[model samples]
Structures are given as structure tokens and as C-alpha cells.
Target: MTSQPPGAHLPDHPEFLWRNPEPKKAYDVVIIGGGGHGLATAHYLAKNHGITNVAVLEKGWLAGGNMARNTTIIRSNYLWDESAGIYEHSLKLWEGLEEDLGYPILFSQRGVLNLAHTLQDVRDSVRRVEANKLNGIDAQWVGPDEVKKLCPVVNTSSDIRYPVLGATYQPRAGIAKHDYVAWGFARRADEAGIDIIQNCAVTGFIRKDNKVVGVRTTRGDIAAGQVALCAAGHTSTLTDMLGFRTPLQSHPLQALVSELLEPVHPTVVMSNHVHVYVSQAHKGELVMGAGIDSYNGYGQRGAFHIIERQMAAAVELFPAFARAHLLRTWAGIVDVCPDASPIVGRTPYDNVYLDCGWGTGGFKATPGLGWCFADTIANDEPHPYIAPFSLDRFVTGALVDEHGAAAVAH
Candidate 1:
């Protein structure tokens, strides 16, 4: 058989980007989970705080879980002020992330449109646009005609089941190569003398009275001055080991992609009413996804009915998508909070930080949270941007609810 030329269909995969190091006996910090958030935090810890004595432990391969499974849509058109502040900060960081990391992340800021279907969606979209504008974020409400102009493939006619009413447009919003983003952060962190240890799962915590002194891992016990939890879906397991509850429910969130086609989809389009989000990836596949599964579980796969609903919504929004063959479908276990907002602050135990409950917004908030998380870890104080999302907010009844604007949570 003739040799194939590097599988032109697949996205360029980086090989041996970072060294696989053995866990040191002790470090100034030990970050659990080597996903995008963990890697970003590690990069910022060394770059911003000058803290290079750190180790990022991963249960599996780097970015092999939710980081690899997400649909890769990045936007900051959130409704609330707290949500807008953090997400918009993330969006700004995304703008210069490639240069800062000294790697090509393939970030495309083509734009994103959050479609409004009914009168309620239209009202909410307009309100969110105004809210975004008030928060210094670039957002505007566009009618169906304008939506059709932005993405020609969209069916804006009123005859559809969920007719296109209008949409909230954020010109700075877009998607990036998820794998490239993770690799970029990992490489930079690894180069800074931070250990990136894969397959090193944290079996338990080594704690003194009200303080986490170290961690017990699969490889061996490693002492730490501070321990940060970035485990995403498995955060509850870690917290359970520490004898505390975070009020997070883990669920399977699924997404899929279609066979590569000519770039017909111009930009990312999300509809919360119908519960389907679509965007054509850099590789030309139509990426699609919807909400999490109804039940709580750690499984990285969802029920067939969820995928069926997602496809139906996709077909209804873009008639042309019905003919495209499905390339593949996958899921990630996302730990969601009661208020649909993330919890990022000091845990009940001293020297232990909490960074979970991002739900579907984890990928978008990677760099921004990393920047702030590094500060939080370095100074032992919550950054102002993430202060409102403290674990104590639940007890204080000061929730930053983002269910309506979170899109996928619908």
C-alpha cells in the first residue's frame, strides 16, 4: 500500500511537547489535575508570581478529559456583572494568549452570535447586550436580518418551529484550538521548571489540623506548602477525601462534530431556547453541542437521546447541516454548582484552594482564572475578580446565578 501523507484530515497534533517528570518529594505548590485550567494556572504561577517550584499532577494524560471534549466556542456575552467581568477579562487575555505563551494557539476571533428564538429570548438577549455594554464588553443586539447577514446558512425565516427573533452579538468572541491552547500553556510551564507529571493521581491528602501539608499520590507521597484543586468533574472526590462538601453535582456534557466540509458556517451561533450551539472549527468540521445529561454521574458519555435532541436542533437552525455525516461524538463530566457559577476561593481547610464548578464555562475562563488563581495562591487571598464566587457565597446567600446566560445549562 502507498504511504498516506500525514492524515490531512486530522488536526495537527503536537508530540513530546513537554518532558514527563517524576514527582518531587516536595514542592511549594501541588496543583491537582493537568487539564487546561491546571496548566494555565501553572504557567501563570511561574510567569506572574515567579513561583517555579510547582508540580501539576494528572490522573490521566494531559488535556485528555474535558479539555479535549469541549466544542471550543469562546465568548463573554454573559448577563450578570460578575460573570461579565471574569469572562470579558478572559476574552481579553485570549486576544494576546498566543504571543504571551510563545506558541500558535490558532485562536480565531471571527465572532459569536447568541440567537434569540422567542419574545422572551429576544428580551433576554437585548438585556444581556446592554449589560455587556455597561461592563465595557463589546456586545449588541442584532435582528434576524442582521443574523442572516452574519451567517448565511442560518434559517431566519419565521416558519420554523423556533423562529429566529434576534441575537446578542459579541464581535470579539470566537473559538481556538483547545489542544493547542493546553499544549502552549503546558510547554511554557514545563520550560519554567514546573513539573508536569501525568498519570500521577492524588489518592488522598496529607493534612495537619486545619492545614493541608501534602498529598498522597499513586506515584508516592509528595509534600506541599499549598495544594490547589483543579480536578474539574472529580473535584468532589478530592473534597470528599478532605472531609468537606462543595455542593457540586457532576454530570455528563456531550458534544459532536460533522465530516469536514467547505467553510459554510461563518461564525459561532448559540441558541439557549432550543439548546444547541454550533460553530465551524478551524479544520472545517461543524462542531455542535447541547446541555448536560439530566442525572448526576461521573461517566464521560451521555445518553443517545441527548445527542438526538442536539442533532434535531442543529438541523432546525441550519437546514444544510441535515445532510452532513457525523464524524464523532464525545462527552465530559462537568461539575456544576447550584447557582450555575463556579466556586474559586479558599476552601475550609487552610492552604487548600478550590477551583471547580465551572460547568460549561471552564475552557473560556482558562487564562483569566489562571491569572487570578495564581494571584490567589501566591498571596493567600481571593482576587477581586473571583471574590464574588467564593465558597462562602453559598452560605451568605450571595449567589452569582448565570443559568439563563450560561447557554448550555438550559
Candidate 2:
């Protein structure tokens, strides 16, 4: 299959050879979860390390999980250095991802502005912007007037509750087409001779001397030299197959899109205090969402009050969006960690690794996550870029606190 190289686009009718490869009897690696991260992990294994004897097991179709449901926002601004490092690495990959994967990911680097609504919010954002710059990440602070100039539709008046005080702007941050990312990674992995088995769910683990050697799936028991569980919201269930436990709590994260209108909202605007985010897609539909459900639940749907308040905040911020017809609303399960960071390292079992606990921020970290995960799985050690987010951090009292920076934008 031939694909137009990046920046060399034709009619976009690239041939595809990726298909349902039956589960193999044994493989060097088996990545569970066929979403963006899983497929990416598989692709990197073959493309980078020449580990082509790999299989990706998915319960559903590729990108059918949170991979497709997310708002597709990408950025690297974080308060902590560790969080900033990996995310910045991810953002760097996102920069050339479409070309590297031979797919047009529709990456628009317009910018991402995190809106501040109160004095404390402004201070917090100011500190974050400074820290981001110090870490060699591009970031800036924009006052209310500059925020309006960036996104003229934003309401900057202090008359309303949680008024727009200012914002932290990342000029390099923006959105990418999520579906292209999924399909692109899948095709690339397939081209590298990696098998992608869909509609197959992992039921249990094959262990020896407390080491996970393989997994028992709906298809059959497939043995592997190593297993990487990239399951997003269902990390706990997958880990349960080994009789182990993690601190992952599943919560509902809801998002909605308005009917297509003329381009009005320019860059992505995320308001943490107001608990809403708005970004105009390439198709002109405004994608909006807010914080996760307050309680833990596995259902892919959340309480209406969460979306209701989100819409209310949207209208308060952009009154013009009030008249915009709501076309569709959906929710995805987000695996929340206690410190609102991600888990991306080895598990208790020697041969098993995990890339879960991303909460709402998994989509943006796809490339970097897979790159590091593939390295970790291949060498049986953690990559320096992803080492800080290891499972031991939870017990080591060295958590990367990104709750305030991530809760609104993911």
C-alpha cells in the first residue's frame, strides 16, 4: 500500500492492507487495547525495534473507545517538571505525526488558551506559564483583553460569575483529527507485519511463577514474551485478570458538538473555574466539554447536570454559542488517578507493563506514550522520558501534580 508522504498530499485515496489478522499462537509482544495508544505501541515496536511478531488485541473496533470520543486537544503546559517533560515530548511528536505516519492527522497548531476567571486562577496560570517557559516549553500569559483579541467571541466582562480574568496561552498547542490518528497508526503497524485482532477481549492471564506470560482472550490463549496493557478506562478490569489492584477510579467524562456553523471560535479556550472548553473543528462545529463526573462510575454516560452546567458555562462565556444548535452529545470513561497524572510503567508482574491512568489526557499523549511504552516493553525497563510517571511514584510520594492544569483541557 502506497501513501502520500507528509506535505505531499494527493486525493487522499491511499491503499489500505490492514485487516483482521487471526490471533497468533505466540508473539514477542501483545498489546491490549486497539485504540490510538495500543496501535501506536504496536507500530513503534515493529518500526523502531524491528519487533514485527506482535499482536494488538481489541475488544471493540479501533478508535471506538475514548480515542474517538475525545475533543482532540493537545498541549504541553504543566505546573510540574516531570509532567511537562513527557507531555512536551508528546507535543513534539504530534508536530510531525501526520507525515511520519503517512496520514493526514489534520493537526492545526492555531493555539490553546487556558482561561483564568479569578485572581487566584490568574496567579496560578502565571506561575504555570513561567514554569513552562523555564522548562523550554513555549507558553505565555495573556490578559483578559488579549484573550478577547485571541478569541473575540469570549466574554471578557467581569459582570458575570467567574469572569474571564486572563489566560495562559501555548502557541504551539492545538487539535488533531483523532480518527486519522487511529487509522494511521493501525495501517502503519499492519504494514510492519503486526497483527491487529479486533472483537477479541482478554478474559484472564497466563502466568507462571507469578509472572504474566500471556493472556486468555475470547479468541484463545495467546502466549507472549511480554504484555502491555494500554486499556484506558478499563485498566482495573484488565489488571484484575492478574489478581492485582491499582488506584484507578473510572469516571464519566462528557462532551458535545454543536451543529456546523461558520468559523467563529478560533483557538481552543479552556476555562477551569467555569468548567467548560470550546474549540472549533475543521468542519466548523464547536466541540465543548467540561470536568469529569464527581463520582466513580464505569458507564459511558454521565449525569445530565454535568453537561447542563457545561452548556450553561459555554453560553456564559460565548453568548453567540447559545443559539448554536446542539448536534450530538456523548461521554467516555476516564480513568482518574489520585494525583490526576498517568501510570506508564511496569506492573507488579515482571513481564507485564501498563500505560493507563491517563484520565482525560490520554489522547494527547498517544505518540509519546507509545514510543516510551514500546521502548520499555522491548528492553524490560522504563524510558527516561516516562520514568517519572512510573507506578512506584504513587508509593514513593513523588506524584506529578497536574490536576489543576489537566482537569479542564483533556
Candidate 3:
């Protein structure tokens, strides 16, 4: 047997990554949501900004929300510069994240293939590949034969419903163990003295004039010098208290996995036309995800038809999957913006920072968003990478609009 690469091994019984601290009476910074984004932000706040007086309040267990529910695909082959900037930055950080956090995240560079099924898809995909290359991201367009060579399980037959004309391949794009990624950040942040308070839901905001001074949580009212909203789907619930509405809609993004199987799939494959994304986990489960549900809801469970439809597409793409037994299905509530991009800047309240509307890109953008958001909260200025994602962009009509590049439908 060969030795595993650094940060690629997981112990059978992992140690606790963080403590179950009680909510403090007040903190210099109060971050809502203890998922990947919230935990990463706290990690950066302590590591980068020297802001250890921070509290990450979560309604549920850490990383148990969308962090555990996501498909864990990481890539930066986007159409727009803003999208590419943040995502590529995140991908670069992911390359060194395990060493930085001093924990195992099991990050793999197995690459990703975004298939193009139609003539228009081919044109758009090739254009995005050029855009990615121009932005210094590793990307290229591969024909059907190349796709087959990369992932032999893929059915590149022209007679299929959505024939694979070609695909944009990102050689560095892959996946990490979502739970371990969050735990690594959480452990580092906790070691730096940042409080990870779980089961403390932020019920409302405490404001002094135009500034948010604290939050009312189930634990109690806690004072804060600054409030950062890193809550994913439940962001609007807190934002509504600020009296301004974000042009966002919440939907349940569904994913499923198959029983343990032999390693047949070696890379991530996503098809916008077929509305499915497939990747094999390091532990042998065939992880798969489909487009978000059409209805506006926050349930962790989605309609069975959505699962049935995605499996149909999966079988067509990988015929061997037709006999795979489904392990389980789950959903994550994602807040989608009208322009298909995120909003990550100042809100109506002076001391409150907004980081929502990530839709399907949350897990991939965790570290990059956390790094930039910590800077935004520390220096009280928008990070250049996230400047284009400010809430004002919606009103100013300067939307990033990544519908075509967001991969999974929103």
C-alpha cells in the first residue's frame, strides 16, 4: 500500500474539531450561521484580522446545514469576470487550505467536466472556456472523445437525449470532503479563541438608530460591535428585520447518493442541459445532484419527482448507474438572486454586512468569501473581489448574472 498525500487521510474516529461553548453576553463580531461560510469567516476574522472577540451563532449543529447538504463540487470556469475572480481565488485557496488549517479536508484535484449538449451550449461553453483562460484559470474545451477518455463511464453517444457535443474542462476543479473542510476551519478558528455557539438562533436584530448593535437569539440578547450575516437560506429572515428586502428567492436544492460501489467514476461531471451533476466520493458513494426545486420553500426534503427525474438523467449519462441502489436523498435551502449572483456587501444598517444569494455556489466559495468578508468586516470596506457583488448592484443594474455559468439550475 502506498502512503496518502498530506491532508488526504481521514482517521476512523476523528477528534472533536470545536467546543460547544455557551453564547457570550457580547462579542466584537457576531456572525450568524455556523456552516462553512460562517465558520470560515470566523476563522479568518481571528487568523487574518486578529479579531478573536467573535461569535459564530448557529441555529443547528455546525456544518449540518447546507455545508453537509451540498454536492461539494469546486470549480472556477465561470462566464463573468466577477464570478471567475472570487471562485478562482477560492480554488487557489483550496489548494493550500489543508496545510493552512492544520487538518485533513481530503481535497482532490480530479478535475471537472461541464458538458455541452447543443450547438448553443457548445458555443457558450467554448466562450466561457476562453473567458476562464483569459482570467488565468486552467480551463479548456474538450470534445466528446476527450470527455470519454477522461471519464469512461460517461455515455457520449450521439443518439442520447442530450448528446455530448463537447465540454469545458477545469483540470484543477474537483471536490473536498465538505464536513472535514468545515471542521478544519472550525477547529482553527476555535483554537484562535473564536466562539462557536450552536443552537443559538438569531431571532431578530438589535439596532441603535441605523446601526445594528446586537442580535436577539434563542440563547439571549447578545451585544455586538458588528453583525455579519453569513446565513445561507435563512438570511432573509434576519435581513427582513433591517427593513430592506433583497431581490432573492429561496429554493431547496436536492442531492442524493448511491450505495458503496467500486471506483468507476474518477472525476466530477456536470451538464447544464441535462440538469444533473455527478461525482464519486472518496469513500465510494456515487454522489449526485440536480437543479433546485421550482417552488419557493425552505424544506430540507424535496419532491420525489425531482429525484426520479435526476436519476433518469444519471442513468442516461452513466448506464452502469441504472442498477445502483440509492442510499439517501437530502436537500439544502439556497437563496438565489435574480441575477444568479451573490450579494456580499453593506446593507441598510451601517454595522451589518450581507453575504447571501450564493445559490448553488456556496460550498466552493467558502474560503474565498470568508477571507474577503473578514476583510470587509475588519477594515469596514468592501474587498475588491467581492465589490462587484454588493447589494447595490441589484438597484444599479450592475448584476453579474451567472445563470449560464452557475451549473445547476436555480
Candidate 4:
């Protein structure tokens, strides 16, 4: 097969020789998602660890799932040490994405300001600021005056239901071009000989005795030495096919983008009190997001109530948003764990791995999770960074709770 260099246009790449009705073929590793995490995992496995025989199975176009649907917020401010450490490392990786991937991810270090409304909110922000600082993340407590200086458009003194008191500022926290990250990894992984099989759905797992051997996809079964399920919202379904239960609930998270305005919003503004966050894209559009659905649903559709509530919150944060016309709205399924942390590492089955339950914070963690997952798959052992988020933690009651501050936004 004539292969093209990484990042070359599709027409320049070799035509896919392996088509359906072609039965089972063996692979060293198989990842069950073509989003940023799975693609990044494939890229790292080949680029970093010299593991070339990998396959990424995608049901649709690459990054057509949550990776494409995210609002693209990246931050490393968390209350717990483990969470802080992992995300901070992820942030660092994001900073150098352009150099590593040889494609500009367009990382904007525009800063993230998480607003505190109540006196209790202010206290919680202070504690979180201190915690993030202790973890060596650039987080600081900013009062109303400082908050105004950072985001002059915000109405800090408004007599709303939840009045603003203070905020936690992280200058290093920012956003990146979400699609570019996914495409960059996909292109590089493809160049590294990782078979990216698109329009393929995994039907079941091929098990030998107590161990998983490979995956049975809609296209056909592929014999894989090891299988890693990175299927985000559909994580539980895939695990169930393998005869294992996952402690996860899938919910729909909605986000909206406004018509291109004249670049007013400079910083990412998050409000725990109002339960909303907004940031402007490079194209001058304002990307706004809010909490998930009250009830769980497999449908990716969102409710009108969420849009109304988000607009109300946005207007409260920045009164000018009331005049800003909402251009489009979209929703993606978020796989949430009971503790709001991801489950990563080897499963009870030998040769089976998992990377799921990321909820809303998964976008920022793509690089970190992918790097650790690649190491785990290549070395046949879970990396220390992912040990705390293992599936066994649920049964053992070892939950890394980030409920106070990181709850809403993440």
C-alpha cells in the first residue's frame, strides 16, 4: 500500500485496502474509539514507545463524537492532589502540542477565571487556589477588583440571585483548537502504521477462557492481542459485551456558540454560583457551556430549559450577552462516574484495558490519559499516574472527590 506522510490530505494518502467481509486479522493493540484520546494513544504507542501494530476503530468520522462536541476548555485547577497532578501534566503536554504533533493545536493561554458568588464560594475558591498552588499549578485567589481587571465585561456588583464575591484565577489555564488536536493525532498515528478503521462499530468481544482476545466489530472480527476500550459515553455498553459491569451513568452535556462578535471575551469565565461558563473562540464566536441534564438519556439531544438557564446565567455574568444571538447549540453524551473521575487501567480480564468515565473534563486530559494508557498497554502494566483511577477503586470505595469546585464546570 502506498502510504502518504502524516498530515497530508486524504487524496494524497493510500487507498484503504482492507475492506469489510474481510474476516479476522491480528493486531498488537486495538483501541475502540477514534476521538482525540484513542488517536493520541495510537500516536504515542508508536511515536513514543515503538509500538506500531495498533488499530483505532471508529463508528463515524474521526472525532465525530464528544471530542468534536466539546467546548474546548483546558485547565489544571483541582482540589485533590492526584487529580491536580494528572491534569497539570496534561496541561503541560498541551502547551507543547504544536512541537510534538508537528501541527498547531492553537493553544490559547488566555487564562481561566472561576467566579465565586457567595462568602462560602469565596472560601472554597481560596481553598482550591491554595490546593492548586501546592500542586505547582499557577492558581491564585482574585477578589472582585482583580476579577474586574481581568474580565472588564463582567458585572461583578450586580444584585443577582448569587452575587459575585471573588474568583480563582489560573493564568496558565486555557483552550485549544479541539478538532486540530484530534486530526493531528489521527494523521500522525496513520503515518506510524496504526490502522484507523472508520465507520466500524464494535459488536462484542472475543474471549478465550477468562481473557479477552479481540473485538467483534460490525465490519468483522479482528484478532487483537490486547484491547483498550476508549469509547467514552458508550464505555458501559462495550464493557457489558465483555460480561463486565461498569459503575457509570451517561448524561447529555449541552453547549452553544454565538455569532461572531468583535472579540470581546478575552478570558475563560466560569461561575459555580450561576452554573455557567463562557469563552470566545479565535473566530470571534463566543462558546458557552453549562451543566448536564438532570436525568440520564442515551439521546444526544438537549432540552430548551438548559438553553434558557444558560442564557440567563450568561446575561448575569456579562450583561452584554443578552444581545448576542446564539448561532448554534449542540449536545454530547458524557460518561460520568459516581466520583466524577475517570476509570483507566487493566481490567479483571487479562489483555483488556479501559479508559472511560471522563465526564466533561476529558478533553483537557487527552494527552495525559493517552500517554499513560500507551505505557500501560506497551509495558503490560498500569502506569502509576492511572493507578488511582482503576475500576477496582469503585468497589474499594476509594473515590477522588472534586465535588466542591470542579463539579459543575468539569
Candidate 5:
């Protein structure tokens, strides 16, 4: 037998610079997922709240879940005040995230354009833009000519079935290297002495008198004072095991990238009417995606017809992409809510918290979600940022629906 170092080529495994250590029998808090959100939560719980006794338990590799599976679009030009507030807080943290974490997340500030293809889309987008501006969110409506200027490669001509009438542009909105986000947070969280337990699948919760005290995992029984369920798409499973129910349903969301190419698209272009959103990555690949599969399943693969429809729309919107070779495709399971928003607050269990139902918007929300969630866990109360997303909203009917999310559902 031979020893291998981190990043050793296969037949060997690649490990993080700060790999997961042995699971402790107990911790102050245990976050059930090691995605960006979980890592960020641990980091904030240590860095911000000074609650360093934390454990992030993952069934797989860190950030290998939906955190790294998204298109990496970051924006907070939501229509409602609640949606805009939390996202804007996340966006602000994103502006300083790299510096705060001491890691290069490759956060870009290019721009994001949400196209309006029909009369209703235009009307709704205009209203959404107005609401965003009223809430002090940076958002503006660009006419077809300006939309073409922002993204010259786009087909704004009226000949197409869904011609671009106008668009809502958020100049601060852009994409980042999604993988580095999780790794960066993990590195910092590990430095804070928070345990990162990998390949440790949580089997069940340890509850006494209806209060969760710890969890049973494949590794061992690790008791904790508090637990945060950042399990994302698998939230229902954990909630089920803990004897509770939520409206969250898991669905497979797919995305694909084209072979590397010369920089053609300057900004992110999204068209809900066409059902395709595309952006040029820092590597010059045409990164694109569409809505989720119509059916719900735990499968990480979506129906081919849905992808075919997305490709058709892509070619229709960007004729230049017609020749771009499709390199690869993949999917991530997302936990969707009926309101197309997220749930981030206390669960029924007194000692358990939740950060799930993020569905399409988890990646962009990593920083803000973690910050507020860590506060909620440490203080035993929801912060103003996550107050609207409380589990009680389902009963109070205080849902904060954003019309901007009506398109591509993110």
C-alpha cells in the first residue's frame, strides 16, 4: 500500500485542504448538509456569533449537492420587500464575501437581464422594477434596444415567436465560481474548529419529550444541543423522520454547458417566455438552463424533452449558439415551496432549526441565509432577515410572493 497526498490523481481520491475529521460524540450544533449553505452557517456561527462548537455532517462531498449545481446567478431585484430585503442583504454580503472569508470566490459583477417577451411580461416586469426601486434595490427596465446593447449576442428582433420587448436589468447581478464558495467557507469554518464530517449520513434524530437532542448517523450517535437542517432537497426526508410535515417537494432541476468558446455573451440573459437562461462563464463556456422537470422525483436527472425544449429556445434566442457543441448536462434535486420561496426558521421541534425549501435560489442566497440562520440558531429567535420566511408563515398566510420569480422560477 502507498500513501497519497491531497489532490493526488485517481485511483486515488481528491480531498480538501481541510478534510473532514472524525465525528465527535457531541457538539453544540449539527448542520445536516455540507453544501454552501451549511458551510456558511458554520462559518457564521463561529465567526459572527462566537459559537464555534459546530458540526456539519454530509452524506457526500462538501458542496457536491445543489450548492454547486446552480447556474450561479446572483441578484436581489425581487418585487416584494421581504424577498428583496433578504436577497439584498445576501448581495451586500456577497460584495464583501471573499474578503470576509479570506478566499477568492470569483464573484463577478457583470449584470443580469430578465427579458420581457409579451405584453404581460413587460407590464409585470415594469411593475416589478418599480417595486424594486421603491425598496432601494438597484433595478431598471431596459428597452429592446438597450437590452440588445447590454447583450449584443441576443436576438431582439421581432421575427422570433417571443421577441424581446424589454428587460429588467440589475447591474450588480452576476455569477461566480460556485465550487469555490463551498470550499472557501469550509476552509474558514474548519479553521474555527468546527467539525466537517463527510460520508456520515444522518439516520435519525434523538428526541426526548418531543425535543430533539441529537441525531444518529452512519458514523455514530452524535448528540448536539441544537440541529440545523440545511439538507436542501432532502429536507422532506429529514422532517419526515423527525415526525413533522411541510409542503416541500423535491424535484430534479437540470442544466447544461456548451464547449468553451470566445466570449460572446457579455451578460446573463434570461427569458421565461422562451424557457431558457444563458450566461457566458469566466471560462468562456455558454452556461445555460431552464425550468425544472414537470414531475417530482429524487432522481438527479431530468426528462430529455425538457432539455430539448430549452435548447430549441436557446437557439431561437441566440442564433450564434446554434453551432456550439453541447459538452455536458447534469441535474440537482431542489426542495420547492408552493410560494416559490424558501423556509428558514424554527421547526416544530424546540431544539431543531431548518434552512430548506430554497429550491431554485439556494446558491445565490448562501451568505445571507447562513448569516441569518446562524443568528436564529444562536439566539433561539429568527432575525429580521429571515423573519418573513418563518415556518409560522404557512399558518399565518404571510407569504411573500415575488412576481419576478414567476419567470424561470428563480
Candidate 6:
């Protein structure tokens, strides 16, 4: 493949390029995706292991996929052991992202409250809080009085659809700037000599004797010693091109941002019984999200009814939000596995690594997933943190089930 002329604009760089640099024909590792996880992987591979011969391929602009489209809520209150441990590590990384990257990720430790409206919901919240606490995360069950004191705008009184009994509160759970996180990682990775290739689509894989040797992209063919697939929603499609079938199904998940208003919503609030979660952005815009689309589709479009249902639920939880008009709505495709957990290890192929099936919790897992995935790629063995999410679990029924907690937007 012919390399681009010297002093060309890098794919992940958003601004104009004063000077273009020549592209290398090969790399030690090629990561497919410029999203948060992909960029983070490149950063760790270079900074942690001194692996600078790396390239990240992106079909569009950097972080144009789920990484930039998420609501940016970060937390570690999962009910399952495997998920809780991994997410806790990710949260710890987020706490120091600004200092580590030298770019402000704007991580706000505003805390998160998982509201329990029914008896069963309360029981589940209590159980998850205990699980998270045992995993060294700050999660606790709070009574109605405590919930009201934390979020006075919420309607926690009785006579509601799902009366608020209590909630699980995580003081460390909060929000971050999604775009900033992606850009911070991208800039740092680029500075470390990792090529960030944008507008590059991986059409096929080059394999010899059942081992992936390189990737064929829209730009051109690039040889690599190892290839890691970090494409989130397009993971199944990419795998199919490589002659493998994944159990992932892509679905559209929608979220909205309301017009700027006074700071009323303090903490992130999620309700399982209502299937809604709401948090206020740093700009005073109330960002809200609901469950995934019922059917499977590659399209990122959602019907208006989805947002309407979510708005109604939000208003029901916080009556004061009744007048907050929504400014815009957006959608993103999520690759959901059968068990709603991720698949993050070697595939059937020898050298091809898999890092997909994030479902709805991928954004918060950027750091931890990258840390584990880099280890898997470097050591040629799945890390203990991600061993439970292997592809073999599907057939062996060793699923790391987090459907209960994730259903309510954990």
C-alpha cells in the first residue's frame, strides 16, 4: 500500500494540519476503532509497554461512534462480581484521567442515586450496594429521608406509580465529558507515536495459517503483527468479514439533552421500575436516556415515542422537570450480547483479539477494558478480569450476568 505524503492531516486530529507526516506501511499492533476504548488501548500499549508501533483505524471522525454519543455517566455499582470489579477499576481511572492525560476530562464526582420504587427494586438495590461495597466501591443503601435530602427536587412521596422506598447511592459515581475523554486519549496516544487513522474502514482481514497478519482498509492495506477488534456496534459485521459469527446483536439506544436551565438536578438518578435515567450536564442541560430499541437494526434513528416515554417517566420521578423542554435527541448503536456482558479476549483465531459487546455500559469501562485488552494482546492470554467474558462462555453457559443492574442503566 502506498503511504500518504509527508505532512498530511492525521485521522483523529480534528483541526487543520499545518504539516503532514508520512504514514508507515506496517505496525506492531493495529486497533480497529478510534473510540474511547481503542484510543485508550493505544495509549496504554505505548505508555505502559513502550509499544509505539501502533495504529487506530476509524471509519469516521474520532469518537464519532458510541464513545461520543453516550450520556457520559460513570459508575461502579454493578450487582455481578465480574462486572463490579472491572467497573470499579475503570472508575478509579476516571478519577485521575485529567491528571494522567494532561487534558481536562471534566470528571464530576456528583454521585449517583439508583431509585427503588417497589419492594423488589429496593431489595435489589440493597443487594447491589452490598456487593459493590464488598468490592471496595462506595455504594450504600439510603432511606427515603436520605434520598430526599440528597435530591430535594425528586418526588419520593407515596401515591406514585412506583413509590420510592429507598435507593442505592454511590458517592464516587458521576459524569465526565465524553468528547474530552476521547480527545485526551487521542492526543496523548498520537504524541506517543501511535497513528490515529480516520475515515478508514476495515473491509477485510489478512490471515495466514489461521493467524491474522494484517488488515485491509479503505485507505489501504496495512500489515501488523497483531490485530485487535475494538469496534463496538459494528463488531459483528467486522467479525463476519473475518469468517467468524458473533452472538452480538446491534440495537439503537436513544438519549436527549434539554435546553439549558438552572442547576436543579444535582446527582444522577436512575429508576429500574420506570426504565429511565436523568443527569444534568455541566452546561445545565438535563441529559436523559431510556432502554434500548426493541428490534435489532443498524440504523441509529429512534421514534419520537421513545423520547416521549422517557420524558414522561422523568417528569414522574421529578415533578419539577415538567417544564424542561428537550433541545435535541440523538441515538447510537450498541452491540449487545445475549447475556448483556462484554466479550473481551482472544477469538477462535490465534492472533485476532475481540473487545466488543459493551451493551450499554461501554463508556464507563473505557479505561479498565483498555487495560485488560492491552494485557491480553501483549501476553497472548486473557487477563483474569476479562476471562469470564470470553466467547466460550456462550456455549458453556458461564455467563457473567449483569442484566438485572444494567437494565436500570447502571
Models 1 onward score TM values of 0.96, 0.96, 0.96, 0.94, 0.96, 0.95
Model 4: ten consecutive residues of lowest lDDT? 14-23
Which run of 10 residues does model 6 get worst, by summed lDDT?
1-10
For model 3, where is the 10-residue window of minimal lDDT? Answer: 1-10
Each model's total of backbone clashes: 0, 0, 0, 0, 0, 7
lDDT of 4: 0.86
Tens digit of per-residue lDDT, candidate 6, span 233-270:
99998899899899999999999999999998899998
| Candidate 4 residue-wise lDDT, 1-410, digit = tens | 24333453446433432222233398889899989889889989998899988889998877889998999999999898979878998899998888898776788999999998878888888999898888899999988899899999999875777777888999998999888788778768877878888888999888998777878888888898989899999898888888889999999999999999998889999987788999999889999999998788877878999989999999988998889998999999999988888999978898999999999999999998899899999998888888899999988998987775573677
lDDT of all predictions: 0.90, 0.88, 0.89, 0.86, 0.88, 0.86
Tens-digit lDDT track of model 5 for 31-137: 99999899999999999899988999999877788986889999888877888889899999999998997777788999899999989899999998998899888
Which sections of candidate 4 miss by over 4 Å?
1-24
Evaluated against the true structure, the overall lDDT of model 1 is 0.90
Off by over 4 Å in 2: 1-17
Q: How far is 360's C-alpha from truth in model 4 (Å)?
A: 0.3
lDDT value, residue 332 of candidate 2: 89
For each candidate, C-alpha RMSD in Å?
Answer: 3.1, 2.6, 3.0, 3.4, 3.2, 4.5
Lowest summed lDDT window (length 10), candidate 1? 1-10
Better of 1 and 4 by TM-score: 1
